[model samples]
Target: MSVRLRQATLGDLPLICRLRVQRTAWLAARGSDQWTVAGKGRPIEIFAGEVGRALDAGETWVAEVDGEPAGTITVNRRSDPGLWSPWELAESVVVHFMIVDLRFAGREVGRHLLDHADRLAERADRAWVRLDAWTTNSDLHDYYRRAGFQLARIAGPGAHGPSRALFQRRVVPAHPARTAPSRYSLQGYSGGNSAM
Candidate 1:
């Protein structure tokens, strides 16, 4: 309810840094396979570097709900190299570090972020959107399947030791309006908007 996605820029670095800590802590609590670093840790510098690169590439996004930052996603052209495979590498839009604040987990925040990435990927002329998840989290894997991603492969057991599974969804091209619609008309809500 009342959620929107904004393009991420250099100004968001601080917020992204904070959210990385929150997300990493939550993942550690779950003892989920998502944590691949030795000692169950991820350096903020690493997150910062990744976010900085994505922003520089014009691929990061932030989701705000009720005027507050509620989620984050890194949508980039970078390929994830460690994922196992039924997933074939294609020229695809890659989505990484998808996180919705745990306070809003049961809500559709994560879905909205992902759907936005899907639309963005399509607009970039990508054939598919790809992502990876920890191999041990059946619940999360199932959640993605329901959201339309097909399991591609289970790669990983990376240096950090947690295996990861790859997933992908083909993007359907959207039909653009030949002429602009009325300024005040509320067009159809795309998947990037709240489900509610």
Candidate 2:
């Protein structure tokens, strides 16, 4: 299957939220508390608020497979407070809120979304793509590792959230001869030729 990514809009809020709920339930079924609160899934309002900010900042993207929403990812320069040092944040793009639809599981949609993040980092002149995975999810950690991300560190006690398993992958040029600027044709936005 081919995966196409486009900038996420406010109209996609429901789809993103539904993806979160669906993934949460899937995780619960596997006995993982990654996105759960007291054995219950996180409130949709809180998740929506977090994603809303990313959407507003134009840092979120939705991946589609065969014209159907299959996954979502958010990549930005901002790191969650205390997750990374200022120097680390300055040189990297932070990935957040990545969720792949259960129906598309094992289809490599997550890999394509992450490849997009790597491209975004290269376009933005960043050195690395960094992310903090759910601390308790060893499977997720292994997933990132298999995706070429190295485990940086587990956040210390000072870190404030369950997403403390830090990981990063260095950005490398896919084609060294291609020096042209990257273009993104985002719907509901301008500057289609600019870097995303």
By TM-score, the best candidate is 2
Each model's lDDT: 0.66, 0.80
lDDT value for candidate 1?
Answer: 0.66
Task: Report how far off residue 100 is in candidate 2 (Å).
Answer: 0.4
| Candidate 1, run of 10 with poorest lDDT | 185-194
Cα lDDT tens digits for candidate 1, 108-130: 98878888876776555557878
List the candidate 2 regions with Cα displacement exceeding 4 Å. Answer: 39-42, 184-196
The C-alpha TM-scores of every prediction are 0.77, 0.90
Each prediction's Cα RMSD? 6.7, 4.8
